[model samples]
Target: MDPEVIGAIIGVLATLGGVILAFYLANRLTLNDSMDSKSGWRKELMNIASKDEITLADIYRIRASVRYYPYPYSETNQLSFRWMSSLIINLCDEYFVETYRDKHVASYKCSNSSNFQPNVTISPENDEIVRIICRYLLKYHWEARQKMQIFRRGRDLMNIDDDEPSEDVARIIQLILEQVDKINSSSPQNIFQISAADQLKDILNTAFKKLTITTRRYLSK
Candidate 1:
């Protein structure tokens, strides 16, 4: 080959190699960032779960901390909401296991009133938390429905009944559904409005009571 042709070939080969190396590094960095994010989220979840007492307030704080950026609507926010909802549900299960199952509360003395409560006052901030919880539960139920549909389509290959949610989860979901129903029926405009603070307070109060009662009944039996 001519000397100029040879140099041109070398230049093209070097450029291609640099582009490939850049692409590989970019992918590797993205993977690393994703793993780090997941690890941090897991640590935060476990930190709450490891607590001696996980209150409704703790759950609220966790939900608030999980940012749903750009406010109101985004695919990233939706996924974050779903993951946060799952974490909250798992934490509730852990709380039940720690407070009742592990303690053998059927044979131990336990107050039905002392299970879980919102430590915060009935203010707009608290109302926002309740609204978030309501939305999370709604999203969870919707996701569960999607899962059920998928299971139904594959029922011949898998036992769909095996995917049923736990009794505790079912009960809590029922509570959320009932509250959501009331909110839907009575004050549609008051979904998350601070102006509808009283209505939100009532919903939260009822939910808290139901949860406490359910926990009590489960522990009693």
Candidate 2:
């Protein structure tokens, strides 16, 4: 082999090795940065979870109005009922479990109302939502039963300031109980742990409709 030709071949080989090394380093850097970003995201998720707690204070306030107003006659009562319905919908949006946090985090936009608008792209597994819903249902039933007993016994409710409102609340309570019972019974708790908030809402809405119809019929009687 000619000496110059051999030297030129060696130079080319060195350049190729240098390029391979550079690419390897760049790939490693990119991978490390991605991992770092993912780690940061995980931390942010934990922070959010720690900060958010679901409360039913708003529902209680609405319930108070139902206790004092008769039927749908009062504008305030009607408004409160609508607000209560919206509160449940809003609560469902706000209390999504861990899996939904990632996508929700990306698309969340704050508004003047400070309302939580869950991202459409976010879908969480059902158990978390279902558990919360079940808990709510249990409370609703217990409260409703207590109120119904009071109404049936013709006992004056101690804290009730208005008789008509007490009757309305009692009616609403009976309706809610009937609906919750129907739903709770139809969808056995073991029917595949709740996988999404929508599923829970479906169970609630279906049962609630039936309950409302039954209650209205009784009211007419």
Candidate 3:
């Protein structure tokens, strides 16, 4: 063989090998970064959900953090998202149930209003908290739909429990939706306006008590 031809063939093989190695390394790095990002997201979600007393603000923050997490591509990531959403929904449902059972049930009268009302005074701050709670409920409903779709498609690999939203959950969502409409109608410009504060507070407090009972009953079933 000619020396020049031999050298040319050696150079071409070396170049091809380098390209293949580079592509492999790049793919490995991408997979690692994706796994890391997903791990961080799971950690944050668990930390929030595991709190002794998770609040609406905490849930809102968790939901916001979820947006920053990478989009769900793998079955693992999809299952994680579905389970996280379920955890959040259950936490909020339990909180409302406990609140109603402990604080508002005694004062509630069937004739006056079918819903329970928390003992807390109606104020602008409380009203704002209620608004946030409504937003959280809506977000939970949306997540529930997403999770159901995942289950329907059998996309998640984990053996997760049933992700169906209970009748009580649906009822509470409807109550909140109604309350939101009332709040919005009363003050189109600003839901948190002082003028509608009293009405808004009453509506929210009633729904909270009703949701609490509804959740408790569902759990007993």
Candidate 4:
């Protein structure tokens, strides 16, 4: 080959190598950033779950803010309210699912639900999730549903067998149903699984009583 041709080939090879190197570095950086972000999220969630007490007000403060963004990134703020709901339940569900998976609760349809049941089985860890669910996810779900355009598929899966939500008991019933709705609605991508029924028999005790009820006849018994 001519000397000029050989020189041109060498130049092309150098440029190609540079491009490949740049591409690899860009992808590696992205993967590292992604892993870091996930790690941060898990740490925050565990912190919340680990707390002895937290209120909706505390959660509002924790919501990723606007004025403070890491180099102008707000993608984390756009996370669906549903995913936030899932995080609490999903994190707690992992340990229990292996040891105490409730077949009926997993399969329970929400449309016909009378009252929402939570497994108050009380794990040494992650038990606070019950309070989080009752306090935030239940109310937030009702509020969030107003945003989406939902096509009516059927009458309803969940129902209250008691008097139509006259006093505050009705509100309690509705909250329970919303939770079951989210749980039953879980899929491979978005998890919201939590046990229901007589498993967590004491669930109606402390955190729940303080959540949304004013006074209720049904809950008294």
Name the best candidate (by lDDT): 3
Kindly list the per-residue Cα lDDT of model 2 for residues 93-126, writing each as its tens digit. Answer: 4433333554545545543445666533322222
Model 2 stretches with alpha carbons more than 4 Å out: 41-221
lDDT (C-alpha, whole model) for all candidates: 0.44, 0.40, 0.44, 0.40
**Per-candidate clash tally:** 0, 8, 0, 8
Error of 1 at 148 (Å): 25
- State model 2's lDDT: 0.40
Q: For residues 1-221, write the lDDT of model 1, one tens digit per residue.
A: 89999999999999999999778656655664586477664455445544544445555455544433322222222223333344344333333233224334443344466563323233233333344454544444335334432224534211123322244444444444455455455533553433333443453343333334544444344
Full-model lDDT, candidate 1: 0.44
Model 1 segments beyond 4 Å from truth?
1-39, 50-52, 68-221
- Judging by TM-score against the true structure, name the best candidate: 1
Error of 1 at 174 (Å): 7.2
Question: Which model, 1 or 2, shows the larger lDDT?
Answer: 1
- Point out the higher-scoring one by TM-score: 1 or 4: 1
> Which candidate would rank higher by lDDT, 1 or 3?
3
Q: Give the per-residue lDDT of model 4 (tens digit) for 1-221.
A: 99999999999999999999778656655664586477564445445545665533324333431113221112221122322323333323333343344433553543366675533243322234344444453344344333332232552212112112232333434455455454455453232244433223233332233332423443443
C-alpha positional error of residue 50 in candidate 2 after TM-score superposition, expressed in Å: 16
Q: Give the CA lDDT, 0 to 100, for residue 29 in model 2.
A: 55
Clashing pairs in 2: 67-165, 68-165, 69-165, 125-195, 126-194, 126-195, 126-196, 127-194
Query: On residues 147-213, what C-alpha lDDT tens digit does candidate 3 reach at each position?
Result: 4221235443222233333543444444444654555555335634433435444533443433345
